[model samples]
Target chain A: MPRSATSSARPAGTAAPAHFDFDGIGTSWQIETPRELDPGTRRLVLDRVEEFDRTYSRFRADSLVTAVAERPGTHLFPPDSIGLFDLYDRLVAATDGAVDPLVGRELELLGYDASYRLRPAGAAERAAAEASGPAGWAADVERDGRRLTTERPVVIDVGAAGKGYLVDLVAELLRGRGYDEFLVDASGDLVHSGREPIRVALEHPLQPGTAIGVAEVADASLCASASNRRVWGDGLHHILDARTGSPAREVIATWVVAADTALADGLATALFFTGAHRLAETFHFSYVRMYADGRAERSRDFRGELFS
Target chain B: MNTRQKKLALATMTGLSISAALAGCATDTPSSADAETVAPSTSAAASSAASTPSPDASSDSGSADASSSTYADGDYSATGGYVSPNGPEEIDVSVTLAGDVITAVTVTPDATNPTAIQYQTQFADGIAEVVVGKDIDEISVSRVAGSSLTSGGFNEAIDAIKADAS
Candidate 1:
């Protein structure tokens, strides 16, 4: 939905106001400070969005993702992409290799190569893909400051976690502009700052275009995954198991609220395979899970601060 | 200032805090799979097979029971065809049964991508020949290596079809 322009910028701690839609992330912002998006800030935000799209878009020809597909090895990178690589390492360490980044080769075998294209459906195709060597999260990937290189020419589909990083950057951009109160959302991964808490409705995986529940948090980040989204048809989606070149089932969706977008993004996917019972041992943040059997569960530690 | 901008500011503040909460350092502890020491190979296969129930199945059926009900039978579900736009298009192909042999295939592009139009023009001819006669379960995603990613898109679309039908 589109947002109507405001007559005047409202001061902080005022009446709850109308929502506005910007750059695809739809949520009216509220803040404790009187910071605003000056011309410089606006340009910076737009530029950063463009940079992110160029770096991670699976379709863009000159996107970093494309470059990775063209040449899979450790190479220099722009700060944004390199930061994500570092975050990938963090996720890998946090999840004990469960969230590995070395699956480019396996992902290609599964038909998720550079173009994000699907393979021709046939027994031969399946057999050939299966016959491909078992390439886990170690096939090819290397990154340094402004340099990223891959071992092989495999598609590095960071769709699983790239958006969150972008959101973090957007928030950082706003903060850099001296705006203390703002909300940054990329698709669904979001981060909030300022005084009053924001209420975010977590979309129901089973129910399209509707939210299952709402969570309230101040100055935090939230990433939601549903067994429902990011999947390929035939029950396969993007959330593949690096070890086998297939999707991770068992857990349907996991929403993790944490302090950073990258961690939240990676944790949301990792949680799907981790399951609810094991969340405490595997995850360090609060989470919620919705299952295929119509069961919605949250971690015992998750603060129930939610909006109606 | 306008009401919209005011709301925007507030929203921004709240959203930032949420992000900050998630920004803490990644924990050193591994999730359950690692804790239980489940071999990645065994768990990977199990997870894949188990994820067959497309999460979107219920939503698809509620839209229209007839198309969905008929689709559940092998006839409408077995169809496999691809439509390529310009560069590479995301397509959905499913297997449906008609009579004894499986027939009917679907190839729809992911409208989200800008190049889907181009993919629709170029990739379909080669893809249709590869998938049409295959069983839904037996259908694999490797027959065409040159145009592989598009095939994965077709795979997801077909999976959605089967999930809706079942």
Candidate 2:
């Protein structure tokens, strides 16, 4: 808790915190730091985020993911994208196919397609969208190094974990350059760095702008998922339970804190299907899960203060 | 652990007001109120606090029954989280301090896996015999009931309590 005023390192002056914000990959990102970020480093950080969008964005025609989706044959997904595939594989297995990257097709069928239209398939959505089995994308797609192939048509959207992964990447960039104490907030998925723990408000699923409680995250990432936001049609939001080609209704919102952002982001989505204890077996995170009825449950390790 | 080459420990504490106030808080439970008090808007305050991982907002103010007490004679409680093969285990510990003596101790473990929870329960039920009446600092958190995951957070809470007391 030593204040900067007493630190010998800043005899000349104290470094006030600075923040850099920009929009990318469908969400805004903010970098919070205690020191001035040089112009070059700022550009590097910005470029890294834009790079991920250009590479994995399913909405963009120029994105590699779109290319893979449009082409049925085998293709290479740039070297770094392999890491993303690895993540998807693990998520598929970890959450019992609850967090599938191949869900892009399901999303598109429901009217959240690349054309930027919200044309949900209508009431018949249940019959038409439920064609694919749970986690079947795992089988449809094959990977060899950077190369990937699918037996049929598919659009892989890293949307769920993409922002989180990029957040980690930017956090790494900051740390690599010697800036230690910082928070990289990609939309709401965030990676916190430094010695002290910060308080994160668990957003209320039903009540917009209201928080269920507060959670603390120290040197870790805090990611949240809510079915209330990003709606396109009747009872539809971004988080589909995979088992059902519709939105998850059991758990309305989840806020999880883990050592990694992408992992935290994925786990938050998984909470819609599984509870705290079951998820604990595969991934390590502290969470607060709010049900549709407003009842909320939290992991014992949750570092933040809970309000009754 | 994914390496994010960041030095969150790098804050020079420049113009830091929170570190100066830590002296008064080392003993009690840090609650949401305390967190909000120091930095009303956790995100903005810490972001404005010159960026040092949000300052120890883990201190829950609701559990401040022993704020006036010290490690020599007071009470402390904290919740710690760790991962086991089952996923994650949360351990909550509350201890009473008498000088260096551990007047009382309670360990609570919460887990998703039944087997993991069993280990957590075993660790909780047996931890008192190892720490109560012993010097708080001397109590080494060895694996108990095969539940090693809960120890890190338990020990962390104890350390937080010790800091508050000493």
Candidate 3:
């Protein structure tokens, strides 16, 4: 594998990758630069995304989510999932289960089931759903070495940090294929390959076009979050709190940089609910926080290179 | 034909579109979501017009209008969620109207990871609800969870969303 300095600009002579369009994991997708990569390289990268989807997707029939939820006390390793169980174990110890995997069952009951396309539910329906489905990470799952069994038949939705990890994998594959300066951005859970830092504009969660801050990242993962972006009156939109099956509202938006995209992605979600003061001891990364009330906070470390 | 090929394509496109949209959404802020919501319905209606206009037409309009209303005044929310092909993890996000424009934001931390139970409910709502009625002009986000770095990125998005709304 060849590693080089990172640059936002595309290199000369390399064919721009082909762009592929499709849908999975409750969202539409498009791939660029597929044409540029060798056939074998392309195949491996694509396979990785599919495997993760199968293990994690609630909408899919054979997903590990369905397998685990439908069958308890069984060791089910997804043929191709993101190995989220592994990440969950890390988070459990890192944040002490502040963000648990077992909350899948409660999330489903809270009206966050797989069938939930991006449409809004009625107020009454939303209220009733929130009533019966409150869950916590404490009781749903028990894990052993590379194996996990759900204590109950709860839906496990992994729509938060999965893709970020995928980005890291694909970026790694690109390096293996001899591409040095590349960005493996899986819907903003992106990782860059190269020594030079890449400049990314941080979007204002509340205001779309305007950039509140900018960050320069080199060989690190960057992730962002925003609360006021998409929601309904019933307080139900995307980004469900597993504990309550509702949207999380602690911090408006969060951005994180870490050694890996997976950690950055998980930390982004964990920090969104964890709060800055609490984050002081738990997380080890550079960050910038924008509050719903217009107050912005940045870690002492994050301030060094992110801003001029 | 293979699922791998499709997923590869999906991942690539998703990455590209996110990059492009991030830049696009930045320039067109306020009305970007409106255009996003309206553009699809208009195209759908144009296609549907070729079909029968039945009792469902009104219903379709109602649903479209409800979602479309959200896009008005640049108070729009677009979620680009994805799950990796290697692990059982996923990311979901939505930007909503705070007060006049969009003043609130929320992020579900590792909705798949079973460890973040405590910060899920009130914290999620608190972040999102705080933006309920605020204008795009006045919005902010702080580190509220274990991952301040992540919260900072989210706050950056809120600023982008609000700037777009105006």
Candidate 4:
């Protein structure tokens, strides 16, 4: 709901809402609310974002994830991380390890490393990475509450769903500050808590500046993922399948709407490798997935319209 | 629990069973020619019908009807078949019911093809396309959910690649 004035016209008397825009976690963020955020509230929101980054960012040298990668031992995360790690646990089981957070090492080997090399590893490097890649989340890690224990070093990348979880966290911050109606947009992931539903365009993966469909989100979260977002080498992208240590090729783009942003975001990535029905068994959500061959499939209950 | 709560729970269980049955043989797999028969159960069909309550029925009368309509506590299994892009596929679905409420469900993939098996495994975890050409500008959208708009690190990577090329 934070469209520019020119894009979204307001009535004569009603003033347009204020939008707080910034960049964090390697992506753009825009928070829209009818009431402007006070300085203290804004500080709280930013601090929460920083705390999340400090805990989960694999790119940062000071992040806890980096510490975990450097040493194999028990690490205690903040209580807030309980939801995230739990969600990852469910995602691993539901996706049959295709959506594991352990895919971080696989991404680094493919040249989407911490330094953002963006270069595909050569055949020899690829073979080595594959041989020593993560041995699945269940085999390598043990999580009890906020305590995560690993037998060996593992690069834990929460890229698939961390952004959306951060959005949810920020939304909670806003609500705690008495801002009940707001929209948190972390780049493409969004959580809406307002009364009126916002119409969101589902961008086409193959065609930039164009959309394949539109989803109406109200009091829910909508998250989108595509193979085109972070492309470097031929057929390489961020959404990777841990089973093959390669980018998923079947579903090129996925849009999921759920009760919360974290689930929506994680399910969006899961849709790339797993079917929506299987996920529905564990989590209730609606989705639309576009295949590499250009055909698109949507859930019967997806609250949106697709342009053929 | 109250009669209304019981009915609501029954409806949800029935819906899940129906959805599982339908999703078992839906789309996304290569075609196959495996013909398998799932033994049909009369109780399953009757239970499904009984799960739907009459809207006008009041609680006092509904309670008695619900008590009489309770399903026999047992496990029921059925096989559902549908044709995919590859060929025909079948899924075996079993449900445990207690007091007419489904307590558990298991969908077993019965396809012989490896691809179908893979798809079935994905299905156990958890479409219409009409082509109407409309310009992006015509639709007024408050925001867009797509591939991430931009990442500073990604941009820097692009710049590094450009520098190397030059």
- Candidate number with greatest lDDT: 4
lDDT accuracy of residue A289 in candidate 3: 61
What's the lDDT for all of these models? 0.48, 0.59, 0.49, 0.73
Writing each residue's lDDT as its tens digit, candidate 4 over A1-308 gives: 56354533444676688899887887888999887989999999889998998999999999999999999999999999999999999999999898999998889888888888888778898787667655678789898999999988898999888999999999999999999988999988999986677899888777766788899888999999988888887888888888778787766788888999999999999877765555766888887777655756676567878887
> Which is the better candidate, 3 or 4, if ranked by DockQ?
4
Q: Please, what are the lDDT tens digits per residue for candidate 2 over residues A1-308?
A: 55353332423564666888777666666787877788989999878878887888887789878877777788876676766677777777876777788778777777667764555666566465455443365677888977888766677877667777888788888889889988887656888887655566555555444455666666888888877666645786678756455667656677778888988888888767654444554666776666554555555456754445
TM-score per model over all chains? 0.56, 0.61, 0.56, 0.74
Q: After superposition, how far is residue A187 of candidate 3 from its true place, in Å?
A: 1.9
lDDT tens string, model 3, A1-308? 33443443556785655554444343333444434556787677778778777777776788877887677776656533435557766665555555666555444544445554333555776577456454444455665555666655656665556767667667777778777755565445567556545566666665564456666677777877666544423555445555444567646777788878777777777765564434434456776665545645555456322221
Judge candidate 2 against the unseen true structure and give its global Cα lDDT, from 0 to 1. 0.59
Q: Over 4 Å off in model 4, which ranges?
A: A1-12, A123-133, B1-133
Please give me the DockQ of candidate 3 compared with the native complex: 0.01
lDDT ranking, best first: 4, 2, 3, 1
Candidate 1: lDDT of A151? 65
Runs of candidate 2 with Cα error greater than 4 angstroms are A1-15, A122-135, B1-166
lDDT of 4 by residue, B113-155 (tens): 5456545644443222333334557787989877748688898
Against the native complex, each candidate's DockQ, computed on alpha carbons, is 0.01, 0.02, 0.01, 0.22
lDDT agreement of model 1 with the native = 0.48
What value does the lDDT take at residue B39 in candidate 1?
Answer: 13
